[model samples]
Target: MAALILDPLAALGRATLAACRTIGDVTLFALEAVSHLVRPPFYGRLFWRAFVEIAWFSLPVVALTAVFTGMVLALQSYTGFARFNAQSTIASVVVISLTRELGPVLAALMVAGRIGASFAAEIGTMRVTDQIDALTTLSTNPMKYLVAPRLLAAVIALPLLVLVADVLGVMGGWLIGTYKLGFVSAAYLKSTFDYLEADDVISGLVKAAVFGFVIALMGTWCGYRSKGGAQGVGGATTTAVVTSSILILALDYVLTEAFFAQ
Candidate 1:
């Protein structure tokens, strides 16, 4: 009986220790990547490539997601508010929801699924194929070359995507409200602008930047550490997507509280 109890406790302890170790390792990795940003020999070409890949290439999907989300949000908000004779509030609801929450969260989740997996697969493949070692042999810093540029690109790109998402999402809601729901276009537009605040949009953009950092950090970390072979790369890709998605959600709550909670 004592042995059984001790075994469970030991397992828990080991898991806890492993979690702490992983956190510490990631923190160190992030610090190293950040340190490279301020150093000489910046990789402008690589940063531009990463920025374009992250921001421009990812725009279409993010746009689609935001538009549909706004349409659905307007419909749902109208449904719930109709009972209370609060239909006029739907515009504010749609705008606020998209800018303060959905825009950043959904955009980040999409990017995490797309770019995070891509980063992991690309870097993990390099690691397994010894290309990372080749970089070292060539007197190149892998962290500076491979990680820092991506991190900077993500931080800058995600906010731009979220900004576009906020606009498209609001437009979607406008379409649904004015066309399908029999709302006056002028009144709806007025309501949207009246209740919307700069802070709402600013908070979402801030959240986007942080989520971008977390996504890039996880993707690069998983990829850089991946080993074994193609299987390892596959695992890292999956792990990067899953971990970044979870972190995006968790951080969303923390940021929301920070920005809005009294």
Candidate 2:
């Protein structure tokens, strides 16, 4: 009995240590990449490429997700508030929910699944195929060349995507409210504008920036450390998406507490 208890304790201890080590490694990697951002020999071409890939290529999916989410949220809000005869509040709730929580969180999650996996696969493939070695041998810092540009791009791109998401999401709510819910368009728009504060939008944007950084950091770190072969790259891609998504959710709560806790 004692042996069994001790064994489980040991296993838990080992897992804890492994998790701590991973956190430290990722922190160091992120610091190195951020340092590259301030250092010279910037790779503007690579940065632009990453920006387009992350921002432009990602727009359609994010927009669709946002719009549908908004429409659904409005419908759900109407259903709930109708019981209390508070249907007039649906527009304000939609705006606040989208700008404060749904827009940023949903957009980041989508990007995490897309850009995070792509980053990990691309870099992990390069790592396994010796392409990363070639860059280092050629005196090109792989971190700067491979990681920094993508990191900067994600940090910048996600906020733009979230901003667009917020707009589209609100529009979706408006469409549903006016067409299906028998709401007056002018009144709904007025309610949306009136209840929306700059702080709500700003808080969401700040959350987007942080989520973006986390997404890129996890992607690059997993890719940079990937080993083995094709299997390893595939594993890294999955890990990047999973870790970024988890971090986005955890950080979202922390950020919400910081912004709104009284």
Candidate 3:
């Protein structure tokens, strides 16, 4: 009996140590990336390309998700409020929910799914193909040249995407309320504006920025450390998406609590 108890305790201790080591590695990688970011030899062209790739290419999906989410929220909220004759609050509910939570969270998740996987696959391939090695031979810092630009671009673009998402989401609620829910456009707009505060919008954008950093960091770190060959690249790509998505969700809750804590 004592042996069994000790074995389980030892297993738990080992698992805890492994978790701590993984966290340490991720933190170390992030620190290195940040350190390289402030050094000389900035890559403007790479940064521009990353900005366009991560921001411009990502707009359509973000817009679509925001609009649909708003519409659905308006519909569901109207249904619940109608029973209590509180349908006038539909606009407020839609706006607050979208701006405070749905818009940023959904947009981040979408970007992580699309851009994170691409980052991992691209970087992992470079690692496997010796391109990263060639860069080092030429006295180039791979983290500075490759990772910093992507990280910077993600930080800059995600907030803009979230802003657009907020607008489109509100518009979606407007359309749904006016047409499907028999709400007057003027009343809907008034309620939205009256109830939605600047802090709510700012809080959501802050969450977007944090989520963007986590997504890019996780993707680049996974890709940078990837091994093997084509299969390794593929695995890294999958891991990037899965890990980024999970982190986005977990951080979303943490941020929400921090922002809204009483």
Number of the top lDDT candidate: 1
Clash totals, every prediction: 0, 0, 0
Angstrom error at residue 63, model 1: 0.2
Ranking by TM-score: 1, 2, 3
For model 3, the run of ten residues with the poorest summed lDDT: 32-41
lDDT of 2 by residue, 127-232 (tens): 9999999999999999999999999999999989999999999999999999999999999999999999999999999999999999999998999999999999
lDDT comparing candidate 1 with the true structure: 0.97
Q: 2 or 3: which has the higher TM-score? A: 2
CA lDDT of 75 in candidate 3? 95
**TM-score of predicted structure 2:** 0.99
* Model 2 bad stretches (over 4 Å): none
The residue pairs that clash in candidate 1, if any, are none
lDDT of each: 0.97, 0.96, 0.93
> What are the per-residue Cα lDDT tens digits for candidate 3 across 1-262?
8999999999999999998998999999899888878888899999999989989999999999999999999999989998999999999999999988998899999999989998998899999999999999999999999899999899889999999999999999999999998998998999999998999999999999998898899899889989999999999999899988999899989999999999
